[model samples]
Target chain A: MTADVAVLGAGMHPWGKWGRSFVEYGTAAAREALADAGVDWCDIGSIVGADTVRGGYPGYVAGATFAKALGWQGARVASVYAACASGAQAISTARAQILSGLADVVLVVGADAAPKGFFRPAGGDRPDDPDWLRFRVLGATNPAYFGLYARRRMAVHGDTLEDFAQVKVKNAAAGALNPLARYRKRVTAEEVAASAVVADPLRLLDICATSDGGAALVLSSVDFARRHGAPDPVRIRAVSTVTPRFPNTVLDLPDIATDSAASVAPPAEPFRASIARAAYEEAGIGPEDLSLAEVYDLSTALELQWYEDLGLCGEGEAAKLLGEGATAPGGRIPVNPSGGLASFGEAVPAQAIAQVCEVTWQLRGVAGERQVAGARVGMTANQGLFGHGSSVIAVR
Target chain B: MSRKRTPVVAGWFTGDGTDGEGEADFRLLGTRCSACASVFFPREDVFCRNPGCPGGELTEVPLSRRGRIWSYTDSRYRPPAPYVSDPELEWQPCTLIAVELEAERMVVLGQGAPGVALADLAVGMEVEAVPGVLNEDTETTWTTWHWRLTGTPGSAEAEADAKGAAGVVA
Candidate 1:
């Protein structure tokens, strides 16, 4: 097999409600990434963009949108959408193009100008749609799902509200250092407690907000990197886009119910674990080799679930790890040193790419206050709505 | 005091909501195949989902109205469209609960009635599925059913019924 592609550059438009078009955010990120990689717009071989459902439709397929904004350099363009995994899908598209010799240098970008509140599907009255059904029939919201997971964790793992609050505390402390984050101010458990309850079990502080942000990356073939005068580069070792097995046990987003295990036997690993397991299998690395992790912390308790899903600790031991500070910056494995969704809120398509951005920074020893010391291997894991799973492993 | 509420969507809960009191109050829902039963909620309108064996036609089934709280949460933030929220008024958080159905063997999520609060709910508490209004406009009122936790007895039977429900999910 051909060696992995080199992550030549990573860039972002600092996340916030800038009240600008997504095209602006995406173009800015793309230009910054091109500049960082020292690659002229004309030199790039291909472009892949993660499309976000925008005003009236997915505004501008990210690739073409950015290309048009960048003045249409005539690079081969491709766009992919996988909900929250859109960025990872874009990265995967770039990797495939490079491996197939379709392009020597590729640019992958994702950006979104999110609406103010909970993300809902386009205005519709479709009974055939499960997403619409959930909202229409049950009035079930995203936080409702997050609350279900939190309550389940408490019942099964005995994870306390305090444990969930600690995740916020640790992540907020780390987020305090992330200038790119929307909420740079640190949060305390007491503050989390005092915050109004948005959903039961999860309060206002426990949930991630919606924000506008953009992230882009420049990737090139190993040979291209060597010829470009860069001796060593952070290599993208694995890009896992795994789908769930037939009998998916966990209740995921958009779906009102989980796949019934009543008929077929359940997989040894749950769907979330399988997402990370596939990445580790592809990368030839285990959780122990990871210097840090970036997980989708939609809620504080969900982050604790991810701790178990990523094999950071055994089931029911996530709270213990938190208690021991194993996931804190100075602790064993720093999880969400970019402050996670707790600080970054969420930029959907851009969020996953941003996770890789954080990993790239940490691996390069550039993550100032939240650095995981001597970091070598880092992994970013996330699951998009529907069945899309995202995991990217990078190494120095 | 009220106009009327018609179930906006059909094939969901089957019961007489307009009746002040009647036997039709018991909601008739969907049931999975006993042999190759794969649970579904919103009453699976079609066939059994089990992959391993002989397929069979689904039957109109009545799910257990009373069950225990498998889990509960709420919508702190107003959800996006298709979900109705009155922006003119300050939004209030609603209690969302997942209750295990005994005969269908799955969990269904529903909004708690007006008085239910998070403090009133806990895992393993007793809950019952009750129909509620989903949305309202001048022309129409959307009606739906949800599980509400009741701090009561018979939770063991509810759990057992959920096991028997065989896998119907919300």
Candidate 2:
């Protein structure tokens, strides 16, 4: 196994449609994380920020923006953007710096003020961008893709609409207890059924929403954690930022076509499965050892896809696992104990980092009502557009 | 007066027939790498993407006109722009299908033919690409492609014309 980075602190600005600058949310979360870690701002050796696409210039150089807002102590800064996987990439960068002894303590932060309704591409016509082409050519929104996956599950795996609703039901129940979640009211299968259909087979409630939020983490070398008087802290064991292999067969977001597999044969394992496999190999642990997981439930059906991808269940058996209550609280292995994107909606850049924060809280046995009993090992999985794959494994 | 018919993006397909009635020899165009033999849609004009193969010349090639439906869905809500549609008119949901061409072993996404509903489509059902209108303004008509089920009498005529077509639409 590779060297570990101690998660010294985890904090977040409560998720919701709070109209405010992203900088405000990120700064608040940073201060809270520093307070939680009991570390002084001047003492941090480095800072990393996951970039948001809006806000023009500042969004691109987010690290300097957060550092300047937090009163620049002249600490080293790095900014990263990988669409939805930006947060994980930031954490990965910090971990690399700590392992290489570039810095003893590093702070990672991400935040976003998302646009309402459908998230669209930037203004003007750019035919070269796939994201723009999907909308202009076919009018395929994000939910359209989710609906396609959900329908495929129904046809191939016998997954009913009820099964997809159950995922929302379970996650909303857990989210009801999470004060930080935007939609805290427990949702019912009936409510999900009554929701408007944004795309065929997938209701509005089945898909995640866009929201304004922020999440931050304070990380340090294990030796530094001990010196700071925290004898034991949750450790980040693995961060997988893998890309898809050539001839990807599945149709993913922002793409109008799958790679032609006519000449070169496709990979044995698909992209999502390969993402988890890499993390497991690096962390030296299997799905059986996971006490809980925080998977990107962009759509309920997608969450079920992650179940099979993470090796929590066999192929086409995710619905069976969900029906068995194996993925709920106090079950075989709880998935998305933080209510996932189902409860929290999506904060884009902040989400992958927030997933790590949720896993950290669960590992500490401090997740309160949503806590998994005797939680020790937790994993978070998320995928971004343009073939970016993110998954992290943390253990106490 | 008729507005000028134009391909929304250039060179992806043949013909500027935006009327959806019949484009006798319309077909989606893609590029094939000479060395690796990998085919790219939306036409990759640059170097071959296959990491294993040495870069080679990418020549434009006509993609298969017919394929089977891999999956399908419909957009009930108006998608956000650069999709040009009249806000003044009530939104009409359209079916989107991913078709798998056996020859290319690839899935291409396209809007289903006007009036084609989800009820009419099934996994592995055969469909053929045809010309359609994306949007139109006073000065120009944006032309795009649509996927319709094969065996329709209109598609049969297009298939016959495609066999003898030599010149690619500029």
Candidate 3:
């Protein structure tokens, strides 16, 4: 296993549709993280920025842009883009810098100002781009894909619409306690059923909305953390950023078809399962050791999918686990204690970092009302477009 | 004014220029890796995607027309472009299906044939790819593929519905 990086501080700008530039939100989050870490901007040896592709030219050079916004001190900078996994990649970069002795302290930041309505591909007639082709040829939006998965779950696992609604109820309740969450009002199964249908078998409330937000983290070498008078801190034990193996059988996003499995057999473990396995292996911990988890609830059904993938339960047992309250707050293993995307909506670039921030607070036992009791080990799981797999394991 | 019949994206399918006036031969086209025996839809034109295989010539291959429905869903709202649709027209929810081709062992996604409602479909139901219009503009008729249920008299009804609703994707 690789050496761990100490999570010196974690911060967020509070998710919302605030109609502000991403730079503003990112700067605010970065400043908060720096203040929390008791590290000055000029003292940081490196900075990493998770890019928001929707932010145009400046978004492409996010590292330099955020560095400029925070006032340049010639710190080493790097930018990464991996759709929803962007923030995790930024965190990975910062952790790498610390472990390699390249930087004693590094700052990671991600932010976004999302547009209204469904996210569309960049303007073009490029049939070469699968994201564009899916929309152009089949009129298949992101919700359409979610609908397929939800329906498949109903057919395969006998999961009911009410079961999906309960996930929303569970998450919304927790989000109500988190001031950073955008949708603080607790949601009910009745309300979820009453919401408009965006895709078959999935309602508007089942899906996450796009939002404007930012998240930042200050990471340092363990020695640095000890020298800085914080002997015990939340440590990042693993950051898994794996890609799908060949012959991926699952219908992933931005693709019109799955890779053929005729010649080569499909992997025993699917992509999402592998993502968690890699993290668990590196962290040297299993699901039994998890005090809590922060999963990407892009859709309520997807949260159930994560349960199975994360090994919280066996395959096809996710609904049963949820039904038994195993995943609810104060239960066996609380999930999405910060409310997940269901409550926070999706700030894309900021999301993965935000998940880590939640885990950090829970591990530090400072997650006021929604804290997982006696939390010591926590994990965050997220998947992004184009086979980008992300998961982070942190422990105190 | 007569608009020219065109494939939405060329070389993805086989079609004749009858433009729904006649039963033009139609089939979805894909490419197969000669080295790895792997198949790709939307026709991979360049190199073999299989990492185990050394570079080999990709050959044009027609995919199996018949398959089983792996999953299905319907879009209740209008999708944003580059999917061409008239904003003036009331949105007609379109059923989307993911069909599993046994021969290729791959799942291909397509719009369900017109009149095929979600209530009419179930997992593992048989489906076949057929020629259909994606959208139309002043000078171009964009031809594409649609997956319609196979077996029983319901298949006939779906075909009739598709013909009746020709060129109206939304």
Candidate 4:
């Protein structure tokens, strides 16, 4: 197993469509995390920033930008971009530095001010970019891909529209309890059914929205945590960042065609499952050990897919598990007690770190209204565009 | 004066025939790895993606025009830019289908034929390729391929009419 890194602090800026700069949101989150960790900015040995493409120049050099905003003490800096998995990649970088003894304390931060309406590719006639090609050739928006998966589930597993709606209902209930969530009001199945359809078989309520938000975490060596007078601390046990095996059969986002399985037999385990398995393997724990999970719910249907991928239930049994209240509050293993992306929408770079933040809070018995009672272990899973895989396991 | 006809992207589709007789001549062009025997749509003229095999030459090959519907969906809202639809016109939802070519063991995405709505599709239904115009103006007609479900009533007649209207033979 990998050496443990203590989560010294976690923080976030409330998610919304606030038309502010990403730097401001990230800086606010960083300060909160630093305060929570009881460590001053000058004490931080290193900083890692999850990169954002929207904020122009500052977004690209997010680490330096945030360091400057926090009054640069000349901390070691690194910036990483892996689409939705950017935050997890940042956390991984910090963990590596701490494990290698390059730094005793590292700060990881991700934040974004999202564009209005559907997320689109960068402007240009560049045909080489797969993202731009998918938009230009097929006009397949992100929701369109979500619709395909939702419909495929219905056809393959007999999942229903109500099943999808129930996901929003469950998550919205949890989000309502999260003070930092953008949309905190409870959502009803009736309200979901009344929502307009964005893509066939998936409605506006079924899909997560785009929002501006930030999430940050302060990570320190286990030795450092003990030295700081904390005998025991919430520790991150694993961070899985694996790429998909060759001949990925699933038609993922931004790709018009699946990798041909003709030449080589496809891997038995699909990409999403591998992401969770890697984390489980590295942490020396299985899905059965998970007290709670935070999955990327880009759409309601996708959440059900994660249940199976994370091995929470058997294939085609996610709908059954949801129907049985097994994934709801007061259930055997509650999932997404932190409101999930359904409540927060997506801030891209901020999301994976936000998941870790939620896991850390739950493990510490400090999640307040959204706390999973006596939560001992938690996991967060997300995948990004291209071939980025992210999953983190935290234990107390 | 005749409006100019052009392929949206060159070398992805077959035929220079403009007559209605060439309706059967339509096919998607792809490439196959000579070493690994992998097939690629939108044609990979580059090296093989199979990590296990040494690099091989990619040869252009016409893909199967028919395949089963792996899954289908439609855009209920207007997509973002670079899609080239006029903003002024009333938005029309477009059906998109993912077809699984059994021989190649791959799935390719394409737009559905005109008037084929979500109600007309099923997960395993068979669909065939047919030439269609994506958009047109006084200057140029953008040519592309559309998938029409096989065995639909009047599908053949409709295909012939669409072919003639687009001024394509096959």
Give, for candidate 4 chain A, the lowest lDDT window spanning 10 residues.
Answer: A128-137
What TM-score does each of the candidates earn?
Answer: 0.90, 0.96, 0.96, 0.96
Query: Among these predicted structures, which one has the highest DockQ?
Result: 3
Pull out the clashing pairs in model 2.
none
Candidate 2 lDDT tens digits, A1-396: 899999999999999999998998898889988998999989999999999997578888989999999998989999999999999999999999999999999999999999899988888979899999999999999999998888888888999999999999999999999988999999999999999999888999999999899999999999999999988899999999999999998999988999999999999999999999999999999999999999999999999999999999999999999999999998999999999999999999999999998998898888999999999999999999999999999999
Rank order by DockQ, top first? 3, 2, 4, 1
In order, what lDDT does every prediction score? 0.82, 0.92, 0.92, 0.91
Cα-based lDDT at residue A103, candidate 3: 98
Candidate 1 lDDT, A107-160, residue by residue in tens: 999999998877776665688888787887666778888989999999988999
Q: DockQ of every model listed?
A: 0.46, 0.74, 0.76, 0.70
The residue pairs that clash in candidate 4, if any, are B18-B169, B19-B169, B22-B169, B22-B170, B23-B169, B23-B170
True contacts kept of each: 0.58, 0.84, 0.87, 0.75
Query: Candidate 4 vs. truth: CA RMSD?
Result: 3.4
Chain A TM-score of each candidate structure, as shown: 0.98, 0.99, 0.99, 0.99
In model 2, what is the error at residue A313, expressed in angstroms? 0.7
Query: Per-residue alpha-carbon lDDT of model 3 for A1-396, expressed as tens digits?
Result: 999999998889999999989999999999999998999999999999999998898887788889999998999999999999998889998988888899999999999999999999999788889999999999999999999999999999999999999999999999999999999999999999999999999999999999999999999999999999889989999999999998999999988999999889989999999999999999999999999999999999999999999999999999999999999998999999999999999999999999999999999999999989999999999999998899999999
lDDT of 1 by residue, B38-155 (tens): 6556566566666665777676667667777778887776766677789998878888877765555566667776678888887877777666677788876677765554432233
Expressed as tens digits, the lDDT of each residue in A234-299 for candidate 4 is: 999999999999889899988988888887899999999999999999999999999999999999
Candidate 3, residue A216: the lDDT equals: 96
